[model samples]
Target chain A: MKRSICISALISTLVLIGLGTAAAEVVMIAHPSVPVDIVEAGMIRQIYMGQTTPWNDELAIAPVVIKAGPVRNEFLKTYIKKSSAQFSTFWKKAVFSGTGTPPAEQNTESKLIAYVAATPGAIGFIDHDTAAEGVKVLSIE
Target chain B: MTSAHKSTFMAVLAALLLGLAPQIGAQDIAIHGAMSQSFMQTSDNNYLVESEDGSFSIFEMVLNTTANIDAKTRIGAQIYGREFGHLGNNHMLVDWAFGDYRWRNWMGFRAGRIKFSLGLYNTTRDIDMVRNSILMPQSVYTEDFRNVSNAFHGFEIYGSVPVDRLGSFEYHASLGSAEVDEAYFLHDVFIKVLAAGGQIPPSLGFEANLDWAYSGSLYWNTPWEGLKIGGSFVTSDLYAEESFATPTATLDMSLDMDLKKLYVLSAEYMRDRWTFAAEFQRLFVDIVVPDVPVFVPDVGVVLMDIPADDRRGGYYGQATYRASDLLELGIYLSVFHPDWSQRKVGTAETEQKDTALTARFDLTDSWLMKVEYHIIDGTGDLPERLNPDPSQLVKSWSMIAVKSTFYF
Candidate 1:
């Protein structure tokens, strides 16, 4: 009976950690001026890679990224299908070749929101619950 | 005039310009420098005797400036220096000097010294942060050949055409006169005179190049993905001629030449962390010697030297894996071969095959380091001058270079 009680206690602790991680929400965001239908994962990949210059359907896709950090890694894996390091190297090569440039990086969540709000075609991400006015939430597949 | 005196005159002129120029529109100036030291141990000392001991320094400095000339145009300049072992005292005349007139998105022209947009790599050769590999692919840009020319003075017309769904097509066409300084001519005097009169000769060789690239994602289900394929080709005319008169006889000679028709084929695939690329290049040079007599002193006989034609081709394949934001690993192999049958005396030809392996790591956003080792196997039948001593064949060399770049 004591062993069963100890096992239950460990399981509850693990569940709490999982719940805390899930509670930290990430939201795809764009400038209010941009009329994007839904910022999907594939679209974000295209804009960041410079494959798509201007968005169609009355919108322009501008992407902003956070500098490499724990939050950046979690967001990229969940939305971009790649890690932060891979994206960096890919963009470095592109920039060196004069073929493309990576999306601008913001140092903090507030900075990201400010940049996206001011830039007409800019897009970025932040904690879903913290998203303020002048930014639209994009859908992630 | 002595080189020192010429350099002094240039320095004085630069000082005068900076002192007297109007300050109303003066732009900011910036200075940058890099110092690197590396050591290596090799089995043989034949390739670079000084390098065999394995310690060297490669240092460089760049003076850059920008002036806001007007709303539509901006002026910029860069002066660079390098010191690499005994091959010290290297300089760059100008990275680029051009005026852009953007009348509209569909039409634009730039005139002055400009970078050759022949391939994806040529335009950004100077920016360290943007390149995919530590060193440029040799097949297209022969950085090893000390005098390999990368930029030309000329005019270019470029524009983009928008498409409905497939994305737009961007195009560039340029025409420019090739420039070769006195130093470059002196280096090639023994074999050929590639320039005349401190500038390109009056014949003023011309170059024309074209590039077509498409940008857009490839999948219908995922329309926002990005993929691009670009290719470029350039051709130029090179000419040199001279005549001599002697008491015993009169010798007249002329060479109407079309050489170094360079073509590059490149494709890049980038999705998330993996990037793959391949490049193939072909270069051809035609040499025509008109009735040049070769005299045999012992037999009192004269024989006309026959002209020859030579061709060279090279290819490279590269792959890179990004472990994280701070570290990247890359491996590439390249092969270069020349048609030995077409070689002539006093010419630039590779009698043997050359293969190289290179690895690069990015320690940080501002620092990059790379190491490359080369194996050169000389063909026994190389031209006499190229291999003055046949024993100098089959050599190997290893070089490690590190660069730290910063931008503000």
Candidate 2:
């Protein structure tokens, strides 16, 4: 009976560890200068779509994006109701027609942060945990 | 003419200049091109004789570059060339050449071949994909006429102002010259009667005429969200000089004809995926033909009478439904009434009406396709040639067209 109990305990412990690792893997990050109020899924979508054209209420909005990847896909699917492929196609049409410009892209989260920091009108998204200096975390609801 | 050869030579020269120019500043030049092919089926019942055909191609290329002349001023130029199959053709031309002095976003001055900022349709009219409908409004911008007779060579002053956090207002005023030559003719035979009338004096031989036209528009966004109002006025003092000779006449005399002035007012309301727009326009023409006599060498002299001035006005309303981000459906109706008192010969003293339904599908990011069908009816006393039977004074026609545009 003791031996069986020990095996059951070990299995439970392993399962707990797995769940902990999964939770820890989530990344959080934001631009250092941005206030917490502006980080929302709708605002992010607006910025990317070129509908929100000002950084502040008084300035024009400039939205930045990262190249398509696993994380980027997850974020867009959850927030923008579109896939990266769809976004690319949409912007391609808009840009060529001179209606609007597409969001600028960087290769990685760090690069996105750097871009948003240097450009005042710029907004960008990164992992939740990477919450680093100079980037603000927009809420994605 | 030598103009064609000269343009070819100029193209070669431009290529050579591009190759030899030094790459020094941050300025860059890029070349872009697009090609599209479409098929159409039409019925003569609408306005003109309609037919069915396939595989027409439209190709265009643009060379664009921008440079900073100084800290406060920047200059840019774009050279464009376009070719249309059998239906129409557009030659190579300078699309834009302008110098910008940007004190700030609120104000600026641009001098060159500036864009006509008259209406929402006018600004992005040249970009095929920017429009939701494949066919633009025939009354505002006719495909055949705009292809050759559109645009101007001149300067413009434009600026924008933000009004207390509600929305911004933008205005542009331009003065320029447009040199255009357009010729159109129709021939029809009625079962019972036959009548025909063309431009009194044929339009030929007279060139180098000067044109003065002006356009201004003001746009305001209301604090009440989702509503925008704008109005534009365009007036042109354009004339063409032509000379015609009768079968027995010797001396070629000059006849001066004037194109009409036009004004347009537009208002739009947008809420999410739904947009409603309406526009009203007035066209005024003072076409005067002087009294002249024709002498036949073998016969005798005949007195030719001239017609009076012509005036026309119309209004159109459109509703667009965005089914999705990539698909749109639109329905529009237009009514036109021409003053027949000004018509010298043929009988067209009535109101003409046109109604159309259109569907647009964005097949891919770079490819767009559109299909439209139009129903046209003519009212009042129709010309004998236009009406085959005396019992009927009205005629109707239907037309169907499909266009596909691809961009690269």
Candidate 3:
């Protein structure tokens, strides 16, 4: 009986750790020229919504996003407070109405890093461990 | 341009955008499209199309591309083709094309053919996959006069102002001209109303010129998440003229109408997997006809003026739930008062009530299908020609609409 209980505990721990990894800590990364080291939570939403755009008078803003997946789900739920469907619908309206267009999407974390690192006006989020050189990390306040 | 020319133009433009965006642009350009087909059937009455016996006349295809040129400036356009019964008759047109420049969170400018916002969903009417209902509440969104109310050729200014800890306020205002070149029902309504006022002609046609319109809306996003309240208003002048073949005599007949006032109150609350929305709107119009000679059957020509005022209003409450990963459900109750000033005067002629249920199924990541059922009471706004006689029209009717869309 004791051996069974120990086995159950070990399995539960492993499952919890796996779930945590699926929703790992996300870091807001941007091009080096983006004029911010840290961004407010509300401002991030606005930026993605195309409301708070422009790093300066001369530079335009670009918001990069991830394709549908566990990491994408966790990031949208934590920051945007919207489901993937709702986000897509909102941008669909914008696109069809000629009001706005959705941000570009990168299918993988490495691609997201590479795009943001190379683009001058890109802003995106990725797993903390995946943050690499050439991109600025904006800590959410 | 002619509809054929427009169709070819849009098709070629779409091909170019899809084919050349990669090589021409230095930044990012995204293209998206949706194809939708629908079937609608009504039990006792004909709706948008000849729905009495089931119709497959509803179809739409749209292609759009947006290019983020730099940051503050972006340009986008959509090529839309639709076949709705006898309305569009399979024609492609430019739905909206505009260049947008945002100066800040509180200010942005758009110039071109901009889709004017109405209540909440008007601007997005052409987007099929965004809503679960195959047809929105007809009382609030009459599909017959779609082209006249779809967009305006002008510019608009919109922005959001956020208040610290209190939420935000968004506003949109536009000034533009609107024309009704081929609105079947609107034309029929005028002819019927004129006939009721005692004018008989062999054949008649109507030309409506909406001189200039000003529309504005303000929405308050409360501190509470997923809650918003807003109001919208539109004002315009419509000058209409009549042309007819008298056959026996020359007739001078003309009329003018003004959209004196139009307003709406809207509210919506959305939470996880659930959304509740409601809106109420009213339109006040005044019509004036100068004393004109009318061709009478046997009594010869006579002259009279038919001046009138009309009030129309409607309200609807809706709720939608994302039932699961593959399905969504929605229901709404819509009430319309055709003659708001005499709302309770005539049971069937003055008011209408519609109860609708909708189910949406997601077959795949790119495909969705929706089935909707509606139970309707009263004929408040049904066109007189659809039924042989408006006075003898049935008070109860039902309809079912099924649609599928592939979007990308």
DockQ (C-alpha based) per candidate is 0.14, 0.04, 0.31
Per-residue lDDT tens digits for candidate 2, residues B1-408, read: 343444455455544544443353322233333445545443442232123233344454545445443333445555566554322345665555565665544556777555566555665455666555655665555443352234565767766666766776767778887544332211111111112232232222433232677878888866555567888766665544344443444334333445455667787776544567777766565544344454558877665544435465556778876555456677887665555343333343455556888877778756788888877665431333333444533356555767777765
- The 10 consecutive residues of candidate 1 chain B with the worst lDDT sum are B212-221
User: Tens digit of lDDT per residue, candidate 3, span B1-408?
Assistant: 633564467556645654554575525677789999999998987777778989999999988887776667777778787888866666667777777888778999998767777788889987888887988876777776566567776889999999998899999999997555456545554567556745545445445666688899999989888899999888888776666565566544566768887787999988877889999988888877767556678998687666666688889999997755577789999998878887778688788898999998888878999999999998887875566466657889999999999999
Q: What is the TM-score of chain B alone in each candidate?
A: 0.67, 0.74, 0.89
| Weakest lDDT window of 10 consecutive positions for candidate 2 chain B | B185-194
Winner by DockQ between candidate 3 and candidate 1: 3
Binned by DockQ into CAPRI classes (incorrect, acceptable, medium, high), candidate 1 is incorrect
Per-residue lDDT of A22-134 in model 2, one digit per residue for the tens? 21122334445444444655556555764443344433445677784666766665555554544664565434322244667899878888888886556666766675567
Give the number of the best model, judged by lDDT.
Answer: 3
Candidate 1, residues B1-408, lDDT tens digits: the string is 433444344445544444433464542222232333344334433232134445444444444444433323334444445554433355544545455554444456777555667655666554555554544555555543222335555777765554546555566677665433322221222133212212222222221222221111111212233345566666655444444343445434454435556666776655655666667766665656555455467876454544445466666777775544444456666655555344333222353333545545556565666565555444422322222344654334444434455432
Winner on TM-score (1 vs 2): 2
lDDT of 1 by residue, A1-141 (tens): 999999898656543532322324577888877776486665675566555545543344557887855567667766655556556646654433323335779998888889899987788878766746677777776
Question: For this target, which candidate reaches the highest DockQ against the unseen true structure?
Answer: 3
**TM-score for each prediction?**
0.64, 0.66, 0.87
What lDDT does candidate 2 reach at residue B64? 47
How do the residues A32-141 of candidate 3 rate in per-residue lDDT, one tens digit apiece? 98888889999888877767768888777778898867777677778887766677778888877777767779999989989999888789998877747888888889
Look at candidate 3 and tell me the lDDT of residue B260: 85
Q: Where does model 2 exceed 4 Å of error?
A: A1-141, B1-33, B45-75, B78-90, B144-149, B181-210, B242-260, B289-308, B340-349, B379-394
Order the candidate numbers by TM-score, best to worst. 3, 2, 1
